[model samples]
Target: MLELVVHPRVSARHPQLSDEDVRVAWQNSFFQALRTGSKNSPEYLWIGIDGKGREIEMVGVPTATGYLIYHANTPLSKRVRDEVKGRRT
Candidate 1:
C-alpha cells in the first residue's frame, strides 16, 4: 500500500492538521491529479475538498505519486483559501 506521507512544513499553516487529514487529502489529491495528468502536459495546481468540505490545495508534478500539501492555514494556502472562501462553490 502507498503510505500517505505528510511533510513537516505543512504545519507552517494549520497547526491543527492531523495525520488523518493529510492522509485523506493526499489520497483525494493524488487520484484527482492522476485523472487530470497527461503525457507532455504541464503540471497542475489542484484544489480538492476534504471529508468535511475544507478546501485543500496541492501541486501535482509530473510522474509524482504524491502531492505537495498546503494546509489551509499557511500563507500561500491561506491566501487561496480566503480568496475562494467567498465564492459560491
Candidate 2:
C-alpha cells in the first residue's frame, strides 16, 4: 500500500483526525474514488473522498511534487460536544 500523503494544512487544521485516520481515510477514499472518479477533468487526478460517519471530507489534487489529499472538514460533534475529541457522542 502506498503511504498516505496528507497536506500540512490538513494536519494543522483538523487535529481530530490523527495520522492513522488520515491513512485509512485516504486509502478508502482513493479506492472508492477510482471506481467513481471522473477522468475527463483537466486537473491532475482530482478526486474526492468522505468518511463513513461524515467525520471528515477530503479532496485530492495532483501537484508537481506529488499527490496531495486535503481534508476540508473534521466534524467532531453534532448537537453535543465531548471531551474525547476522537469519538462521536
Candidate 3:
C-alpha cells in the first residue's frame, strides 16, 4: 500500500481562502507597492476580478501608509509587525 499525504491547496481559488484569498493577494501587492515606494495611493481598497477581466473593488480605505495594509491576518503583517516592534526593544 502506498501512502499519499494530502496537502491543503494554496491556490487563489482554494476553498479555505474563498473569502480572504483576494484580500490577501491585494495585501501582498500593496506591500510590494510600499516596498517600491510607489505612493500615489497610500491606502489599498480590496478588489476582485472575474474570469472576464471585470474588477470589483471590495472595501475602502480612508487613509493608510506603508505596509500597514497587510496587517492583522496577513502573512507579511507578522513579519512587519515584529520588525517594527524589535526596533523599539
Where model 2 places Cα greater than 4 Å from the true spot, the runs are 1-3, 30-54, 63-66, 76-89
- Candidate 3 residue runs with Cα over 4 Å from true position: 1-15, 20-40, 44-60, 63-78, 83-89
| lDDT per residue (tens digit) for residues 12-46 in model 2 | 87777665666565555432232133353322322
How many clashes in each structure? Answer: 2, 0, 0
Model number with the top lDDT: 1
Q: Give the better candidate number (1 or 2) by TM-score.
A: 2
Tens-digit lDDT string for candidate 3 (1-89): 22211123322324433334444344333222122232534433333442333332222223323222222222334445464455448
How would you encode candidate 1's per-residue C-alpha lDDT over 1-89 as one tens digit per residue?
A: 54444556665556766556656665665223332444524544456556655656654344356444433331235645564454435
- Give the best candidate by TM-score: 2
Each candidate's lDDT (Cα)?
Answer: 0.50, 0.48, 0.34
Model 2, global lDDT? 0.48
**Candidates in descending lDDT order:** 1, 2, 3
What C-alpha lDDT, on a 0 to 100 scale, does residue 39 get in candidate 3? 59
TM-score of 2: 0.46
